[model samples]
Target: MTTVPPFQRALEAHGDAVWRYLRGMVGAGAADDCFQETFLAALRAYPRLHRESNLRAWLLTIAHRKAIDHLRRRRRDALEPLGEEIEAKPQGDGAIWSAVATLPPRQRAAVLLRYGGDLAHREIAAAIGCSEEAARRSLHEGLKRLRETL
Candidate 1:
């Protein structure tokens, strides 16, 4: 069997996760652009990737950074107010997704990474470019805020 390049293998493995992360970051509307940008950036940086043990985490880290960058740039340009509320049920109770969605970007990212993506604290920290402690704090604060809304 022909061997797949590391970069290609990484893309195949993590593409959906990265896209999901981007969707949570930028909403579904702009997710495609952010996804493209993320992989493009990854393709450029793939040669410098020295670790093969945790390619999923590495690719997620890049995607997270790209999503943040995209959000920053979008904020600078014409920005639209967040539209509509998303309703979610936690522990079988209905809650407004808008309430949780109101969290600051980093906290939202942390929460989404944890609950939505089923990632561990370390993985969330890697994706958000923060310390594991910071990621934990964000998740804690997000859950606290969400509870208040509930």
Candidate 2:
């Protein structure tokens, strides 16, 4: 049987990536709460998980759902810039992220999982809960929109 890492170890290893994904998904404003909710949900389900493979993808899947739920609660189809009061971002990144925030939900999640989370297309598909072809399409559509907007 495959050995699963302790839950804390998985958290330590993947926390930053998950947080960044959440930040990119829901924006910095709600990332912390989303992050907490993601991990809490993951922790609850971890013991039932059968394999250690693709733990990052599994965590990201939870994060994606949490982000979607958060967005739904706010009653928005697209994310919006939280303005200058938000946390510091790298130079010239604001415009791109602003454009990213305007993408449709699946497109945005696919883009963030691929680029922001640095996950492969297969993993992104798993995270976004779609077929690989769908994830690729979403990524393609999202990048196309960003290019057109920026």
- Tens digits of lDDT, candidate 2, 1-150: 575778999999899889878877777778899999999999999888877468888888899999989989766645544433133555457777667777888998998888777899989888777899999999999999989998
What are the lDDT figures for the candidates, one per model?
Answer: 0.72, 0.83
TM-score winner: 2
Largest lDDT belongs to which candidate?
A: 2
Model 1 misplaced regions, further than 4 Å: 1-6, 84-100
Error at 27, model 1, angstroms: 0.6
Q: Residue by residue across 1-150, what tens digits does model 1's lDDT show?
A: 243366778777778887766666666667788888888888887776665446667667777777778778877895764333123213232244555557788888888778756689999988887899999999999888878877
Error in Å for residue 149 of model 1: 3.3
What TM-score does prediction 2 earn?
A: 0.84
